[model samples]
Target: MIEFIITALEALALIAMAALVFNSHRNRFLNRYFALFLVFLALWVLCGFPQALVQEPSDYFITLVFRLAHCMAVLATGIFFLFGLGFYLGRAPGRTWRGSVLLATAIMAFCSLSDLIVRSVSYDQGRFYITNGTAFPLFPAFMILCGGGGLLCIALKRRESIGPDRARATYILLGFGIFLGLAILLVIVLPGIMGSDITSDYTFFLVIIPTGFTAYAILKHHLLDVRLAIRRSFAYLLTLIIFGAPIFLSYMIFRFAFESHPNLETAISIIALALAVALSPSALRWSNRIAARLFFSGLYDEVGLLHEVSSIFTSTANIREGLAAATAIICDALGLKQLQVAIPEEATRGKGNWVIGCVRREKDILGFQEVEVSASPLFLLHDPMLLDDDANAGVVEDVRNAAMLLEMRSRGIIACLPVRGPGGNVGILMVGRKVKRRALDPMDVDLLHRFCERAGLFIENYLLSSYLLSMFEELSETRKRLEESDRFKTDIINVTSHELRTPLTILNGYAFMLQDHYERFAEDERRQYLTYITASCERLNAILDQFLTVSRFQAGAIRAALKPTDLLELLAEVKAGFIPEQGRRIESDAIPLGVRVLTDRSYLLLMLKNLIENAIRFSPSEMPIIIKAEEKEREVMLSIHDFGEGIAQEELQDIFQPFTRLEEIDKHQVGTGLGLYIVRLIADLLSVTVDVESEPQEGTVFRLTLPHA
Candidate 1:
């Protein structure tokens, strides 16, 4: 009778579990297969439950019941294999595998019903048993093959799966392995080895263990996602354990202790009931806590999540670092595989548009890929978007959005939430599929929405602050440049005025001398005065010419007219421009004739003149300046070598900058500091390469390389 009661309860529990699973996901193949397996398992238990109550079962009705029970067991084992395949694939088993299962089921069912498997049913020694036929070994062999194959599939899934899927696989594997292995042991292995039928009666009773695990996995690990059922079941179970344990314990103790004292037993039972009632409030609190912790460990309360997110973003100054940290926390709290943040490339100043902030993979870090979808379009979504149920199709109405979603899905992203600021949408917070592969529930979406909102505000404020700080820095730099310009202007006025005063005064003095003593002076004396005036005027004209060249350079009015020219002629023309004293110091003898380059004659001439003049100004009076030209494979190299107090290394790089003067060199040299600056400008326009090498007290050399014509 007790066996009958337990069997009935186990069958009913399996039926209830099947109903829950089937109702949880009516369309999913995984759910359907698992539920079908449970239903068939319940049938097996129900049909076999009567075997325990059968005493003299040698009739046709009793034999039919026994055959039906074995047939149900065979069918249930096949379905269990199918369920394992579906669970492993996360979908229905393929047509080939299903066809094979159907074929196997037909053969197994026929053999079970006929006398080939179970020859007869009999009652002996207060227990019921089946007499095996010649083919009875096939039944146990089929059971081993199907059950072991199912366990192998589940084991493979557990090894490969991550997060909640791994947990589910583990639970199912444990449950299935324990019950199936025990059933095989009791029915076949032990019955043959120990030579006893002692454990056969309890073999079918073990089905409920795996059934319980499957139900738990469905509710707790989101295997089928009957979350509400999970909560209620936990609550009821906790209530039973917390409130009923004490009362049941008291009754058990009092029943034995006060067998003769009925009055004392009644009083103690009443007191125990009162104690249970007194503890109900605390028990209820604990029940809620345990349920929440067990099933919803990956989530926090909305307010707490919001507050924590706010703290993270507000406390961080760097946008990328902040997003990374926040996403890491959020992914952990929400059980996500990866969380990505996409902002406009413009806003990040060309850093990157997508920040793959955090990834929660198992054991291996996922490789980061550049986001192919333009983030500009994603910002258009004002609300959060969940991808299509198929996940291969798009959920949005627009074509572009659909395409973007397709691209997103290709990259493993399943959801996109807009991060909007006061102005508008600023960024997108993208999440990949959950680690557990569960659908995004309302609580998850709500938390993500709130997180995006906070992120938008934080990013907006941070960008605004960055913009203001950049503006302040720009203003500060502008002020510094203005100060530098003012100093340059003052220096230019003082240097030019002093340079012009001497030349002008000399011209004036010579003119007055020539005018006043023209009749009394000799021809040689008047001619000398005229020559002095001419030299001073030329000096003035050269100064004004330099000023004009600098003005034209600043106005971007310098244009080079190119032509082929002889290097030797160019050298002569540049040398002739210097006064006799400077000209006499320069040597241009080391040039090969017929060496030519394509260049602007005027530009090349001016560049050479400036370099020669700079050489004359820096070198000692007695030292000779050598001008040389060399023909190379691809180019012609012209060099002006000066033996002078050479430029310092630190000052060499800055020598081409306008108004830059060497501080360590002789201060007596007279000219605007535009010689090298003009050479550089003309060099650029003429496509000529200019290089300088110098050493203190050794000499300086400026080499100009032009392409050979």
Candidate 2:
């Protein structure tokens, strides 16, 4: 009954440890090593059995099975060494180290096959005779080399390491070291001291100390979960296997320990009884709480972290601010050193500079251009790959891609997480290495990917919204311009109505007198009245002509018929219309008579007429208005210079806008502000380019250039 209880308890404990290992993510190096360690340890336990149960003869299958189990035990020792190395390094053993380990295992296998490790088995007087093989000594020596050497390596490295890595290494070595020391004593040292007359049935049970400690590390400190996913059924199967194997194995070791030493057996039983009685129910409960807390701590923290991030996402509205906040919060939660978010300009289809939208814990902005990402060979890389800084051969082979760009922007970062849009990758999320100095695990990458996807969508929507806002603003400005144009038109009609009404009323009164009372006035009076009517008629004609010109331009009804025309003659004819005042004169001597240009004659004359009129209006009463023709290689230039209170240099362009007038101009000047504006319009219609040069209080010149015929 006691043996059955021992077997059941040992199996249950091992099975629980196996379940802990199996339930974690398998991609983690530590979890993978831990899982393999448990498998081999169980295989070694299965080979131990009572002397009567196994046949010693070469013909018996039981003898072969027992021998095979012995070989498996030696191999398990080598694998445990591997696990120890991986635990400290956070990766698989390098190629050279792995090769050496494999070589050692093969040599031990050859020794076992040749009956050197386990020579033979026999039935001696109803008891088993397990003969010592010649190479059996190699087993004890190999065990010391692997197990003892692994502990020393851990101790040396732990002293050199710092932070959480140091703490982890320390715990692993202490737990594993104690377990190995006890096993060696029971299997080898104790037998030598007691003259090979004692065996330990409890050697297998000692493994629970190391196994349970590792399980606690996984749950409390988040060790194996970096990239882990373990199933439930696989863990349960391990329990069943461990339960049956230990019972058979313990009975065989029991016979060896008690063969010739009754006192040794009694001492083992008393030690076991003492341990059970000394621990009260309350102490057992305290141990249970510690175990349960270790297992559930990581799960609780993960849930809380996830919840906090979700809350942050829900509250965020603005793209830039939200990304900034999200990255900051995530970094804080995960203990990341840095984070950056980048997006390309959608307006120029990624031709423009990329928008470096957000960063957390970065000292400066990463000015990555949009073309760097767009034209890169790895632009379409879908998944996140490990990025190494100072990479000469592998990841940095292409410097133009997103990964290299990210690395160059900042140091100590791990991976470039792509935020994929419908039109492929539209943005980037660069995550820095964890503050713990470990590379981002697979699970960390996966979580970041999920968040980045949602963040990408938010960024896309925000960009679209911003684009629409700009378009609406432009439309609003255009509407304002149209409304102003309508107001100006109304003002023009009112001014025309008032100016024409005075002239029309005077003409009406004069005509009425001339038709009714023909003999009342003398010859001189009749001549003077006719002259007055003619002046009024001319004033009306000027107003009507300007209105017609503006209407034609607005309706797009004016088409200039370009033909060869003398530029000098056109300016001369327009200048002739401006009558000389007492102080002002229209000078045309600088222009030659036959300067030919490809222009519409009527439009050229109209442009010159407006320029000449404007020159007369702005010039001082005594100043000379110069009409000059200058020749360039491809065009003929007609310039009108005014030496009046010349336009301010800043207002030169504004003077060509309809109804725009200089503030310093005389209020009594009898002219509309539309002359220069009309000249620009006519020049445009005739395929002519007009330019203005002016200085404040000096002079103003309007140069109209027409292509040479």
Question: What is the per-residue lDDT of model 1 for residues 1-709, given as tens digits with 9 covering 90 to 100?
Answer: 7887887789888887777777655776776877888888888877654545655556466667778877988888888888888778766888999999869977998899998887876555645555778899889888888878888889988876555667889999999899988988887787677644567667777877887787777666666665645554676688888778867986888888988998887888788878878987778778877888786555455566778878988798977677777787788777788888777665555545655477866843343434444555553444645453423322256676676676677768877878888877777788888778886754577578888888888888887897889989999999987886686677668667776888889999988877887888899888888888988998889888987886687668988877888888878887788779888999985699899898999878888888888887888999999988899998999888999989889988999976777342238547777778888888888888999999999999999999898
- Pairs clashing in candidate 1? none
Alpha-carbon local distance difference test for all models: 0.77, 0.64
Model 2's alpha-carbon lDDT is 0.64
Query: How does model 2 score by TM-score?
Result: 0.44
**Which 10-residue window in model 1 sums to the lowest lDDT?**
386-395
Model 1: residues >4 Å from true position, as ranges?
1-316, 328-338, 345-376, 379-395, 559-573, 579-601, 627-639, 649-654, 657-669, 680-693, 703-709
lDDT for 45 (candidate 2)? 57
Candidate 2 residue runs with Cα over 4 Å from true position: 1-366, 371-448, 454-458, 555-566, 576-584, 589-604, 620-622, 629-638, 648-654, 661-669, 680-699, 704-709
